[model samples]
Target: MSAVLEKATFSKEAYKEAAGRLFHNEREQGYKPVGLHLYRLPTGPILYARVRMHKPAAEGVYEKLIRPFFHDGIEWKRGEPKQDNGKLLYGLADVQNLPQALVIVGEGEQKADELTKIGAGRLAGVTSGSASSASHADWSPLAGRHVLLWPDFDEPGSKYVDAIAAKLQVLGCALQRVDVAALDLPHKGDVMDWAERFRAAHDRTPTADDVLALPMTKAVPLDPPIGDPAEIDVWPAPQLLSAMTAPLDYPIESLPPRLRAAVEEVHRFVQAPLALVASTAVAALSLAIQAHVDVKRAERLTGPVGLFMLTIADSGERKSTCDTFFTRAIRDYEAEQAVDGKFVIDNYQADLAAWEANYNGVKEKIKSTAKAGKQSTTDLREELRDLEHDKPVQPKVPRLVYADVTPEALAFSLYKQWPSGGVVSAEAGIVFGSHGMGADSVMRNLATLNQLWDGNSLTIDRRTSDSYTVRGARLTVALQVQAATLRSFFDRSGALARGTGFLARFLIAWPQSTQGYRLFKDAPDDWPHLDAFNQRIADILRLPIPTDEGGNLVPVMLPLSPEAKDAWTKFHDEVEVSLRTGGELCDVRDVASKSADNAARLAALFHMFSGDTGPIAVDALENASSIAAWHLSESKRFFSELAVPEDVVHAGRLDAWLIEHCSATGAPSVSRRDAQRLGPVRKREPLAEALQVLEDLGRLRVEQMGKQITVNPALLEGVAL
Candidate 1:
């Protein structure tokens, strides 16, 4: 019993091979129904068998039945085992040509035998579980002097034979089809079913005439040629001999017109490769942006956070094809929908269409139906203005305020809403900041993105083409989440600007691939800040940190007093008027000079504080120290260190030098009084105060390129020489 079982199990490998053949051929067409199982092979080989689950049985039973042919050479693709009778599907092997030509045209072991009886070599059959378009290609190298194409006797079978015939013709083989008529003569079924039919007929000889006809298919006739396909790329060849057969003395300008045209054509063909080379180089370089990229004299900027939104969309398609696009769209849809829904609830309360349909009803109700009386939209909007959100005033919600925004600016439109859970949306709050309002949606999104970030760091075994690898985690989830998108956008295109503001503050880029270039086309936020975000990436990616003037930090002062704001606005207005009126009278050079002066004035204001000239001038000293360090002509290492803002330091050694020639009791220098600690003169005026401080300390804030300096007394406070 054991020997018989071993032999039977050893032979099962052919069946497993047939299953694998069916799998690879079929799975490519998408239906992958089979699992895997360890099965016995005909060579006493224990191997993985890809089986389709056709009947229900205990899971591990098939492995037990086929365990007898165990061996070591066969590799396994370890997968889930099929149950029941283990209807094998595909095999577990890297597809290759078998040693012997096991020409399998599938049915079962019996049908394969029938095929062998006629023209037997190593005849076999792989099941029709998958699309067999691959049979011709995969079997080509294996098709020795013998080749067969036997399929189920049907229309599909005929087409299969025809396809194989055309395909084999390329390999110098005439395909033969397996017709089933001869196999049916045995009994009621095919060649494999010949056992029952053998009992009906007195025929033991397995030489069936029609069985041989199965392996035959003629080549398809070619279409009559109109022109060769090569005509598309055809070019003229070299002329070995001229009409004279000897080298003619070619004239500088006397060549015949037809021959010249031919020569010109030849010249063009000759230069084509060179042109292609130059074109490719130009294309590669064009993607790199070239511009006058000095940011405020090359200062490293770390300003307020700038946000960018990119909507990756196809011009004509209904939806995007990016991975996880649907989920992204759903979020976008929900956000935009929330905005729209809020507008409706606040303004219409009831649907506009429904109201319009009942416009007569509203008017009718104004007289007969109920409370309040309003008709026109102007009045309707005003009436609903008070009823924006849920009433009865829920606690903790901040009241919103509104302002009319135009195409150029973000509208500061605010309204009051009861608590939607103490949500203090900066956008919905009273400070709907200038054009800065639109970034609110993306901001709220980012504040929540940290939750989705997984803390894994991936260590790649091999280097791939992709540059940014997110530790061990996938950026896909982060990208799909709220903040990753905006973060990526700003990091990409923030360097590009329309004037100073980014186009994205007004528009969005493509959502999925808003990487480097895609983010740049148009931006609407703070372009400098957008560009600044990329500096953070240099550290993360281990590349050199890109410095703008070596990371210059710009400190902008805000107006603490209403008067300063008013003064600023007026000054700005006057500057604008001066430029517009004076510009017309001057030549282009004169106009440019005036513009430069205006720019200087604006820069001054941009760096000013509301504390009059005192603090602004003192702060100006710190600025001058930094400015001097950045230049080629006035670079100073010690002065550069003065830019560092700190709490406290040394003083005794510097103090001794300040009060030289002073007597201990009531001491007075030749020109000044000596005190234990004498602070610099507070000149009250901006420039004077600035200079006195700088004289005592080591740095000064020079306003214009070569103007008077604003100095800080604090730098000299605790300094030791």
Candidate 2:
């Protein structure tokens, strides 16, 4: 009870000092402090130190304050305190009582404290925690004494003496010398041993010489050190040199007269990006001509330098000028450009929606017509006319046909899986369409281009000039260095373009054209400027585009799942039970047998149709469906799946989800139930279990009247599904 009262008598701020002398080194007397712990705060990145920590205290007050930090990015792996052997000890004395210019200088608090045993009346020590150096007291009276640096015989002891003396000398205290080997202590014992020995041997205060002659004793240093070896050993970076060479390594080839002037003009700006240089020359030349509004200027006419030249260009004189420039002069430096047809094809892909629609619609029509009885050549011709005119085109059913438009369907399927869509050639603008496709890919593919439409027929919905120009970098040398990178790339490829993927064989145009090049280069400026240039170029050179516009994608074409089919049958019979007929709002209090499952499907289906950022966004699933909402939802699903990839049983569930939703939404445009019923399919037991899982996720509500499925629409993004 008295100890408790005494403990409570301490001031809050003075707890550290009072606790130190009583708790420290008193371990030999009992109640030896064993452990310590630190707590970290998140908001301020604050650290709180706790002394005398045991498992219970560490886990109680300390743990409660710091444990929550772990969830806020703090690490819990930093556990347990080290045992500080008796080598460490502490002391607390009124600093105002000490005298100046009086005693020994040492590094550690423990060693400095041993000065008291040597019979010094005005001894002072650095009061700090274990293994720490350098501290100060607010009112130390021992500020001006001659300090004797009595370090041990070892290297560290010698270093400590040197450091301590240096600081004491600066403080106007004379450095008293002490020989390391004669300090009369244990072989490797520190200042504490010397103090103990001196106390036992002498009855009064010891002089500098007496202390100096004592025996070898190791101790910590009182001052900061000199130049660190690590810092001194750091090396500087090597310098790059520019020297005059013996001769130019580039080939000096003869130039044809017609290409000579143009080549030289381009050469002047070649130090910049080719696109920027070309555009600058064009703009300057256009001013010189003063009457040009279109890309068909007389001065712009040129020829193919190689198949790679076309690969790098979309329209206008880039191809022709580059070709003529390269072939007309060996010095033309086309080798320097190193444009490959394949690179261009990889970068610039075509939209194949029109081709895919035509293929799919025709294939299905042909099959349906043949089954119903017949198809004529007139029908085929009519279909061809409609295709050219952006109208629906039905395939002709051959009298001897076993399949309808199977080959065309194969081509359509081949295109969807194309990793990098388009041809690898310059001569014919890098063919990217199809004339044939393998039979194996029909079910997997969605679209293909039928032919290379006439260049004059190219069109975009907006005003022309879809081409974006990438201005060259302003740094002349850097631009040249970047240009040289292309040559190195080509040289590494053994001076030949690479392969186009498996689709090349299907496209007849790919064989005749050179392939492997990037059609667009990086802009010297920002994206906005590049976008502006693209708009300008697109206006100047519009290429023919073939697409299907009217026959929009069926966004909600869901697969017929057994459970979903059954639910739809019941929901249709009792539609009024959950929703009012033809009303937008619903009182969905009751539903049964996988209705919550249907709700999950709705959410996913809507996410798919919503236009959102995700891997599936590349598919433009929402845009094609003209339903951005579902696409957005699919994107959400894609990301949520990132944390739990195995959540979806299979990809086919995406299709099944869509089917269930359209049935529930009761959209007028959607088709009704199947005529050929496979009635009452088996209920999925695992799926029932899956419902519990989703319910746990708060994705389903099973209270009140019955099970209620709620779709959190906010999670869905992009176009409606």
Candidate 3:
């Protein structure tokens, strides 16, 4: 379609030498010597030639093509208009010129010319590009014409045949494919190979009549014939299910040294679950310090360092032990505060009573003096004003953590306390199966959590008198649920969670169970890591909490160092790439899209936890990026499992059952009737549906002749299930 086709001219002999005998013969017929450059050696001499061909439908419409030499291992290249060459066919002008000719369609320009010389009417090369590109070719030129297709004998050739056949059937052409397998040919052999073998045996090229006489198969249309639908097999196309596997390993090394050492010690006792719970506890600790720390990504983009984390593992994984070990300092601090808070609360109460008594006495005196019509009641009124001005203020207790509370109550605590709170628990059902997570309140709870994660205010308006607003609140939450419970959460809230961006805001981990591996081990004489870990947490708790002029808690911004900012920017940009179409996060883009923001928050948290009150360092951001990378991988795996269609999941379950129940010998077949009677599947419709899916997936095949299902032998190859 360009004004002029651009090509590097090469020597005729050079073209013949590079392209070999097949192309040499084709060149003699009509192939021209136009060349292209090879990859990597851009300045080198031309490596191949472009074969110009005209469109059958129009004149002066030629497609640019490049056929490279195999010696150089260079793939065929195309010019600008060649990405989707659907409208153009090779040798199209020749085929269009021949009316009522029995067109022999094959792959390559050389083969088409070979067939053309053998008296095959209007020989046409399929410019559909490649085996994978077959479906994109223009098959309309052969519409209503009798066409014979000779696909190369290979797996890709079979796909090539299927693609062309599907298009031909739609175009309503008279079609048949040469059964290359029936004829003895080499692996990945072609139509020319068959002809050459015949020539070698008979001392002459095979004619059109002889080639037509060979066994051929008719094309099968995708749609069933208009008759009894029961006669046709109803198989749904198989969707590619994500590989069933555990989430990526938790990033224990990403933790700061003291924390990492402490996690390693705890992991010796509880294994990977310890790392998961510890990571979550760290996130909770970040939330407690959220009001006192923030990451300045840019002038317009400063964010809280809080994190919401969820860990999923089966019970008896010592999830509680891991939580208790990391959270001991927080609990001890809360206890200490409770002890100190009681006396302060009592003193304030007693002072409030005395102040009220004094104010009442002053007010009574002012009223009596006014009623008696006495001179100058201004002195008594000024005393009442003084009493009112001296009214006692209630003391605020510094409480840091919350457990098993509804979202409404959580918001109230945030408002009444330091505008910072955390929900820390080993049981996830408290969050997922709570009354607040019911149908009516699910969105409200999820929305509230999402706001808190963003460091935004939550306004809880209710018909009851307990309505309140929590402004500038920071919330950190961590929960560990069983796999079954997690699945239930997905079932109940997955769509809503994704729609409201609730799931995206949380860092999630689903670690492999390490139940049997744990053994009794004595601690080292100086296990200072655990002490240092708790001590660091206590130190963070004791940092003078930043507050506004009105005594309201405010976030203390923690800007990144120049080195950390540069590293974080690069990491953030890399994460942004995955959110694009066809990337790893394409399916779970809802969560994947938020990965970088989560990384930024994590980097700041890591810096603060490392005892750095200054700017965030490069090492801290690097470690946080490592942790974020793990979470992103786990999120992709987790969501892929969650995204598996209901029917596909049923098919997978049935697949496992079939693999389990099959007889030792490969001869046994299960009857559909008997399967319904004795199989793991109870419902006929769903069982039939699942079986149809498994058949489509090549896991098994069903035949009406036997009314039985035979599992594919390949399904048992090197696999127990």
lDDT by residue (tens digit), candidate 1, 679-707 = 22212343243333334433233345434
lDDT of 3 at 103: 75
lDDT (0 to 1) per candidate: 0.28, 0.29, 0.67
Indicate the residue-level lDDT of 65 in model 3.
Answer: 33
lDDT by residue (tens digit), candidate 3, 1-721: 1221124334546455544432444454454544322211123333334343222334754333343331222111112122122324545555666666677777655566677667556344344434544544456777887788888888767766666676677677888888989998999898778888999999988887777788988765445432233532222222222234324456677888877887787666556565575675576567556878877986788877888887766566676777777878888887888899999999999999999888888888878878889577898888888877788877777776777899878888778765777888788788788888887888988888888888776788889687777777788888788756767776777579789988888788866545544566775667577788888888888777787765666777888889988998888778777667755566777777777777778888777777776888889888888888888777776776666665665576566556545643344366777665655455777788888878766567788773888765323322222
Q: Considering TM-score, where higher is better, how would the candidates rank from best to worst?
A: 3, 1, 2
Which is better, 1 or 3, measured by lDDT? 3
Deviation in Å, model 3, residue 670 alpha carbon: 21
* lDDT of residue 49 for candidate 3: 40
TM-score of each: 0.24, 0.21, 0.57
Candidate 2 regions exceeding 4 Å error are: 1-103, 107-110, 113-122, 126-143, 159-171, 174-180, 186-188, 192-385, 388-721
Model 2, span 1-721: residue lDDT tens? 1232222232323334433433343333343333332222112121222345212344333211111001111111111111111111122232234444246655444465555444355554432222112211111222455555656546545555554444444455544555656554566566666556666788655654565555433322333443244522211111101110011111112211222234345444223224323322222121111111111101332111000011122233233343332322211222322343334433332224566677568767767776777555458557856676764233211111011233233223222221011121223311222222223332222122212110111111224534221111000000111112322333433212212111111101100111122344443343342233333323222222112353211122233234434443344334334345422113211222213222222222222223222222212221222221212222222222322322232212322332244334533112112201111111344344443443443223233343333222211111123
